[model samples]
Target: MGAVLAKSSSFLFILAAGYLLKRFGVFGKKDYAVLSKVVLNLTLPAAVITNFAAMEWSAQLLLIPVLAFLLNWLMMGVGLLASRRQAAPTRALFVLNCPGYNIGAFALPFVQSFLGPQAVVGACLFDVGNAIMCTGGSYAFTSAWLRAGGQRLSVRDAARRLFSSVPFDTYLAMLVLVVAGVAIPQGAVDFISPIAAANPFVAMLMVGMMFEVDLKPGYLRQMGLVLALRLGSAVLLAVAMYQLLPFSLPIRQVLAVMVFAPASVIAPAFTVKCGGDAGLAGCLNSLTILAGILGMLCTILVLGVA
Candidate 1:
């Protein structure tokens, strides 16, 4: 328990450090965009490749994507129902904010630290579906919902968006190598290993830099409702998985942690694209990160794993 607490504290401390640095003008908000690109295009992809390369392939692992997709759709339904009475743009933001999880940047570090390589692989595989939702599913849903007449999204366009994600592309490449019994050259692995190691710190720092809170009229109430519905669904799902699933401990643990992952950072951008309030979305995203950290810490303690 002490170890888990220490680990959680260390992660939070780094996050605080980043926030403080930004507050002090050591790094400006503009710098965060550069840093985000670094994490997304470079460090994150390297980390995905490194971890996936090290994993043992299994046919049973196919379940991860299926589970991930189902969970996201379920939450999308919750979000849509929760905001059905809102105006179109606000409704789009509410629904957009609910489904995607910040698995790669937020959940990966904890899973890697507390679980093992197998769990890392499980988390990464689950992220395959998540990346799809983050990049394309949310946008498509919002567009259809907000259109005067509901419209279907182009499947090809969505696929193009999904395939263009660097981390997702890396996942595909690594999976191919794993299935073909190909090994990454030790020299190349050595090159990537250090960059991969930077993922957790860079990711946490990005979250801290992006953190903000807003207390405008009715904003708190809306944020509270969205969070309540999201977290409530997570609790029910966690209970069901624990009591009913036939999976092993590690798989259950990975899913449990993932259930509480923060809203995707791309959410605010998507909200803006849908003509919603980006500031409110950003605030909600930040708060979810804060809440997710606490929720995951509790989850770890309850599971009695460090």
Candidate 2:
């Protein structure tokens, strides 16, 4: 418990530093886009390539992505049902914010520290599905639903977006290498190592740069409802995986930590693109990061090094 709390505090301190930087104009709002691009295009994909390139292959490993995809769809359904009575924009934002865990930035470090290399591979695999959802899947779904009355959602456009995403492309390349028993060259891995190491810091900094808390009555109510459902689903899913899944302890641990991960960092971007409320989405994203950190701390304490 002490160790977990210490790590949690260290993580939060980094977050607070970023927040302070942003607050003091060390990082302007527009500067966030620059940091975000670096994270998405460089560090994040580098992290994925480095992790997945070294993963040991197994049929059981395939279950991670499938579980990730299913969990995302389940939350989307819950969000849809919960916001059914809301306006189109709010409903779309609610649903968009529901799925897609922040696996790469927020969850990976903890998994790597506690569970070791093989478990990190499982978490990376799960993040493959999440990358797809965060990159294009949620946007496509929301756009289709929002335009159900008129024009059709452009499947081709969505596919193009997904393929063009740096993280998704890296995931595909790594998976193919894994399938063919091809190893990334030692030189290439070494080259990416330093950049990959920057991923967690860049991710947290971006979150802090974009952080905002809106206490307006209507927004507060809506955010509370959505967060409640999101965290509740995470708890239920984590409990089920821990108790009933036949996987090894490490795999179960990865699954549980992932469930408690916050909403994707890309969610607010998608919300803006879908004509939803970017401010609200950003608020939710920031709050959930804090919530997820606290939640994972409790989880580690409860589960211990199982």
Candidate 3:
């Protein structure tokens, strides 16, 4: 128990350092945009390639992506339901709020530490699934909403837009790396290792940057409904699935705990780029991430792992 708390504290501290750096104006707005591009286009993809390239493919692994989509969709449903009785901003918050673990940086290493090497493969699968759902599913949802508001996107145009996105490219590169059996040079691997290693720090720092934006107090009160539904649903579903699924205890527990992880930090940014509400998305994203960290710790304790 002390060991787990030690590791968790170390993660939060690094996260706090990033936030403090952002808070003190060590980086300007342009710097964040620059950082975002570099990390999304180069560092993250490289990390995914290095990780996925080493994993052996399996049908069971495919289940991870499918499950990820279902979970996101389920969360989306919760958001939509919440919005039906609320205002538009609130609705946007709910929909944008629904996502599973932040793969690659935040969840991967933590998972690897507890579950060993095999969990890296699960991370890869989860990443692929998340990319598809966040990219493809988000586009579809936005298209519908925009068209209802008198803006329509043709099938070709939507596909072209999605293809041009970085997440799509990252997913494609990871797939190619996994299928082709190519080996990255050790020097190149060394170059990327630090970037990948710095992932969680990047995530927490982004949260701090959002904090600097000075959101309304009422906005947070409004978010309380969403926080409960989204986080609670994830934890409850994870527990139920872990117990009922026909799998080994380890896999069940890991999957359950991971589900409780915060929504992917990148999703709100993606939502903004894809023409969704970036600020509202950021609000939900921040709160969920804060909750996810707590929920995941609880999940780990429940699983009886030290």
lDDT winner: 1
Residue pairs in candidate 3 whose N, alpha carbon or C atoms collide under 3 angstroms: none
lDDT of each: 0.81, 0.78, 0.63
Tens-digit lDDT string for candidate 3 (22-42): 767786644556655655666
**Comparing candidate 2 with candidate 3, which one achieves the higher TM-score?**
2
Give stretches of model 3 more than 4 Å off.
53-56, 87-89, 112-114, 142-195, 201-207, 210-215, 246-251, 264-280, 304-306
Provide the lDDT at 305 for model 3. Answer: 68
Could you tell me which residue pairs clash in candidate 1?
A: none
Better-scoring candidate (TM-score), 1 or 2? 1
Model 2 lDDT tens row, 171-206: 778877888888888899999999987877787777
lDDT of 1 at 183: 87
**Total backbone collisions, model 2:** 0
lDDT of 1 at 131: 82
In terms of lDDT, model 1 sits at 0.81
- As a whole number from 0 to 100, the lDDT of residue 29 in candidate 1 is 75
Best by TM-score: 1
In order of appearance, the predictions have TM-scores of 0.92, 0.89, 0.78
lDDT of 3 at 16: 69
Model 2 per-residue lDDT at 93 = 78
